[model samples]
Target: MTGDGWNAAVRRRLGLGRLLALGGPEDGVWITERAATSVLGAVAAALPGLAVTSLRLAPADPGAAAEPAVPPPPSALPPGPLRVSAEVVALGGRPLPELVAALREALFTAARERLGLVVSDVDVQVTALLDDLPDPPNGGPPPGPTDQPASATATAALTTPGVARLTAELGPPVQTAEGHVRVEVATAPPHHPLEVARAVRTAVGRAAPDADSVAVLITWAG
Candidate 1:
């Protein structure tokens, strides 16, 4: 199917809601199904050696209508809790159950804290186990500058103390600009945001000193 057609089908199957207005109508706070999905996707993508193949959100009541019945009144409220499900491909040798459990926790925490939405359930399906390839013989003749993958940048960020995990939305973790390196991360809580940012900068610097500069973003503190 075409992209738009596929999205329409997903909307029909999942019964997604439109942008939800929160608090007084004049307050102007709002959240969209797309936003919620983005948050959840980020959480899942952050897991080391795991790749999210698909993510779906379903209404708490499966039979609910696909579209809202009427325009919300002035005092708009959030929608009911949702059910989240995902398909993933994992690399490395970590136990599947352990990874799923961690993904569930991260999803729950992120949904609650970021969107104030309650996720009633998180179902993770491991569709594939990727083999870990052995390193090139003799260290692969050292990578040339700019040959580094974003995953390497993410690994450098993960090395920082107290960093729980990088957000999956940060695809490839490293962005290069004008000879500088930029790294973005979302960390689990218990550590201050500023401290985590500092740690990430230091770690990235050590890992890639050739980088003209290292920029770090703490997308999540808790």
Candidate 2:
């Protein structure tokens, strides 16, 4: 294959992993798998002797999932319960199962309480046991605004509660197309991502009353 063709394929594979559902039907929020997994890696870094070597988030069961209340943008994942699959390497300290259990709990707690991700299940695999701790996992790049014309509703989205800033890759932070609004934001902590997204939706709705749907994509959260 041509180098450019290979590069394009790689980009598609890596370009902002899968979108994972963040909240219920009305919330209309999704988070990139890369962003969520990066945060989850940090959660493991904080735990004693546990390192999340890798993680991925995907729809729990697409066939059994109910249709989203509002149709999602073609690029975003359909709203549904999600499952986390992780591989971990542990330092010799605790029972393997016990350590795995703790790792699972940490992922669940962080995903739900801190990020408001609709993570219904966590599957952890202990890949290795180490004699000494490995270097802490590094987070992926933080979300930043994409290069596109900022819509008039940008201010409204930024002014919403819990929104820290806007971030995107291919389009403006705030985008409205065909009565649908797609907002990509970096949310501040102490407020769940879902809550922040919902507020953004409300604010955007007020700003563009004609908008029929809003999809919030959270790029970062403390």
Candidate 3:
């Protein structure tokens, strides 16, 4: 890559923040920062007159989390409680405090219910008082090969007790390379994602016994 290209790539990553643990270190599941932001931003945009201008997440206390039995991905932070900082724009009319309070509660609830994210707190920064509501934005991966390790891994992951479904409507739900197994899943509701992810790991183990490592990324909770 050229100097300009490398700088652009670094800036993009800085904007996305880091991979977030879905439940805990023990769960061994993670979601990309971009995915988490999309979830939270959608919740805010749906509210009557508010819109999220920015949304970011970070470990509430990185030092509190001890080393895990399984290491997290190199780009991921260790499992720990997370803190959310969101900047929102709201149209004038309702009290400002009410708008902030509502957005905060909605975001917190969505983080836990929809994503199974353990958020320590949400800090809302009202960036602007918009004169009107902003227009909402509109919104595939390839199909997985039918044979071999990925197919078997996909089957095992889907059949796992707490996995809800494949995480994305398009792309392959499971991918494998050498000894590494990577899977993305939406877990069944009311089940802690950590438990579900751990189970998926076990299932992957049984299905791909020769595999050296498995990584589960939970993109949704229900």
Q: Point out the higher-scoring one by TM-score: 2 or 3.
A: 2
- For all predicted structures, in order, the TM-scores are 0.43, 0.87, 0.72
Q: List, residue by residue over 1-222, the lDDT tens digit for candidate 3.
A: 899978876775564457787776566678767667766777888888787777899888878765544555557777788999998788887688888898889989988877778898899988788788677653122222233233778889888888767654212467667787778777665676667888899998899998877888765544
What's the lDDT for all of these models? 0.55, 0.77, 0.73
Model 2 residue runs over 4 Å out of place are 1-13, 145-151
List where candidate 1 sits over 4 angstroms from the true fold: 1-30, 62-70, 73-78, 132-222
Name the candidate, 1 or 2, with the larger lDDT value.
2
For model 2, residues 1-222, the per-residue Cα lDDT tens digits are: 799978876784466788777777667877777767777888878878767778888888787565667657556777677889988888876688888888889999988887777778999988888898778766755655445345657878887888888876435677778778888888876677778888888888788888888778876775
Please give the ranking of all candidate structures by TM-score, highest first, separated by commas.
Answer: 2, 3, 1
Ranking by lDDT: 2, 3, 1
- What lDDT, from 0 to 1, does candidate 1 have? 0.55
- For each candidate in turn, give its C-alpha RMSD to the true structure in angstroms: 15.5, 3.1, 5.0
lDDT of 1 by residue, 26-145 (tens): 222233344446656767666776777777666556453232222332222334456778787777687888888888898888766655554678888988888852221221121112
Highest lDDT: which candidate? 2
Where is model 2 poorest over a 10-residue stretch in terms of lDDT? 143-152
TM-score of predicted model 1? 0.43
Query: Model 3 scores what on Cα lDDT?
Result: 0.73
